[model samples]
Target chain A: MTAPALKLKSTALNSIHRKLGGRMVEFGGWDMPVQYPAGTVEEHVRTRTHAGLFDVSHMGEIDVRGLDAVAFVNGLVSNDASKLVDGQAQYSALTTPEGTVIDDLLVYRFAEDHLLLVVNAGTTDKDWDWISSHRENEDIELRNVSADYCQIAFQGPDALGILQKLTRLPLSEIKYYHFREGEVDGVPAIVSRTGYTGEDGFEVYASPDKAERLWNKSLDAGNFGADDGVLACGLAARNTLRLEAGMCLYGHEIDETTTLLEANLGWITKLNKGYFIGRDRLLKQKEEGIGRKLLGFEVTDRGIARDGQDVLIDGQRVGQVTSGSPAPFLKKNIGMAYVPVEFANEGRAIEIDVRGRRVGAQIVPLPFYKRPKQ
Target chain B: MANVPENLHYSKDHEWVRVEGDTAVIGITDHAQDQLGDVVYVELPRAGDEFVANESFGSVESVKAVSEIFTPVSGKVAEANDSLTDEPEKVNKDPYGDGWMIKIKMSSSGEVDSLLTAAEYEDFTKAENE
Candidate 1:
């Protein structure tokens, strides 16, 4: 007899996504929308020019609160959590002892004793287990609050204008990487001025029961008919948007086999911030130099270089593509690859084995596309 | 529902062929374009190239994926839709008309009879979607 397939979980906005004609797909064991009726390209361009609403409820949230929260949490991740002030958020990662990444996550410091760690959905259980195993009788309290709350991201240049119509709070007061508690559509929510897309936006966290109301109200405020109106974006657009911004995806860019230094996340490694998990190996790698580096490149020739495609230098495979797609906003095919350090220089000629044919490409600077200043 | 012209012959791979005497124009069906989302690039075979039935002659790349286009019948390429090289979105806009990918000189006209009719192709797509 064959084993039955595992059922995928759904977010609070699952039905809402279906109602909006979202094409559902399995992502990290969760049934999420890959694109809506307007399509991935439209949603991608909409986010760049106007605004886009994203159902990010599938992400996991862990609460770390207690007297020793700051010190304890600092010891668990690579970045210095002690630098975070109340209402501030820091992008950090949880790594193993060998200097490899467990998962890239956001660390929010509500207070010295109260902190929230927003992690990727697929790694929630593993992250919880990793954190628990490292507790070792510490005074910090850990609670998995993922199931209790739902998250939505409203992103774009016009995101602030649309979101400002929903909540009475001064949205501008919340600076980038900062958050504020406010009522969205009359439901209590934690609104943070942060997003994965390279655009000005806010992420709203609310109770699961009130998620639908917030989603609908935010869409209504966006006025769907306007050319620069809001769109219900899905995971497909999110992937391309993040890639064009040169942000790393957990499994694609940094996994158990890849370290922070090789992933070009050395800025967040903080080797000299005292001893932490993976500190020793990271320090050693820093001194001896990394063998490979993640470099962003644009396909100078025809064809898109998909993930797992080999990066070739004179017909010899040096690395593989981590993530790649047509950058809709930039109108160029771009991707990131882990290549040898010598071939990581900008303007270096390279080739990507797209399908069976070799396609010409050139190493470019990170962030294939950058949003214009407001 | 997608537009499936009853006059055209379709392959299981989602390509549609419009026969005109010895020459036949080929392009992807509306359903195929819909599934592909927004098309960004199209790779077409060079004119005068020969392809066997069910052979992958080219590929259509969208923002989400790359789909190979197969020939419905063995033929020699007479003309390729050069317009798609610069404006691939034409495939998404008018898959049946200006977005047509190629015109082929059929090696055997009888080969078209083995392909699926519009009704059969529609049923096939419906069942596959389900």
Candidate 2:
């Protein structure tokens, strides 16, 4: 996420982020805000305790139309797109022939013939090219509609109540993993009850031009809820939040080398659905048993084990940490790493080389934090 | 505008030093804490450890990133701020006071001459930011 050779792109709410005193940084080749004035930890805690607004317009969206949509998409991804009924969405990934991930995405089934694939921002162009090039006399109309919409995540415990005030749609009726087309603050948008922060919330997609109105009105109505108001969060909080939820961030946890099972995404990879890209590789791996697994750990001693640190055991490099950061809510330095399946058990002693300093840590369960049941 | 007290000298590395006779108290500056966001953890050289001027003495960790805290003067550690081990946010709340990382028993007092004064440090930070 350093300064790229190519010019950086700005989201629809870039100027508004600057106006709100957001600390902007170069993320995924886009000028993105990493944190607002409220700061990362506070913004993170606020989202868990109440609500937070996030502008995720940079995430790419592709519309799959025509009669062969289901079959075409099923062949391209690991998840069973055929299982998805209209108005439902499923977490999925696009993989290569070797069973390694190209990008993790959400498959939103509008109908059997119509669907939307939401992809990571940095891999949008590459994902489109991969999908379009796989066409073989299929009736699929693949279109990358990334620029045609603005996505906002309204997330937290009270996100449902707060966002309900801005729209006439019955927000409660939109179950988790389900979406509905509705008008919010007079702007037509697609509202879903899904989120990355492991909370009860919604991710709304609207026209780019109407983003300012939706962003402003949503923040202005913060007082309509409890005290402290909804904080305008940035990518930093989003990263920590998703990590705490044990969600895999593309390029970090799962890459072009890690398999779906090894990344702890076996639930999403439905091999029985049949004849998908990477299916044979995944099937063979599943039958042979995975050699390694992604597991969570907490630093028992001082120092933080950040990303790219070495995960060691008995002074030998066993694996490497993929995602490591402070879990603000858990109040602990935690991370996830790929280690031998035998060493992935809970409470296994491990060491992480934090800048050549071997720090003591223990393998804990996945999801360093989970929201309480309502 | 970050508060740059006229009483202390500063380093180009965004650390500040408050010298009292041969003993020097050091911590990251207000601007440094602001740029680092929330201070979550700090790793400092233990007492009796020695360091040379401009050398990395310890590290200050925030939620998103970590930064090395450089020594402004050559010295042995009189006392490391053990309080920061439990309450690191003091660095963000009071970078000049309780957030102080270490007190150095200075071996080279003239090393302070190479450090920037309050006015110069302010200009240095402003220029570096620009």
TM-score of 2: 0.97
The two-chain DockQ for each candidate, comma-separated, is: 0.46, 0.52
Tens-place lDDT digits, model 1, residues A1-374 = 12228798999999999999898888898999999999898899999999999999999999999999988888879999999999999999998999999999999998899999999999999999998888877778999999998999999988999999999989988999999987987889999999999999999999999989989998999985857779999999999999999999999999999999999999898887887899999999999999999999999998899999999998899999999899988989999999999878999999999989999999999988889986
User: Per-residue CA lDDT of candidate 1, range B12-42, in tens?
Assistant: 8899999999998999999999888889989
Instruction: List pairs with backbone clashes in candidate 1.
Output: none
Q: Which candidate leads in TM-score?
A: 2
> Which lDDT value does model 1 have at B56?
95
Local accuracy of candidate 2 as per-residue lDDT tens digits, A257-315: 99999998999899999898899999999999999999999999988999999999878
Q: Positional deviation of A110 in candidate 1, in angstroms? A: 1.6
Point out where model 1 deviates above 4 Å. Answer: A1-4
Report how far off residue A114 is in candidate 2 (Å): 1.5
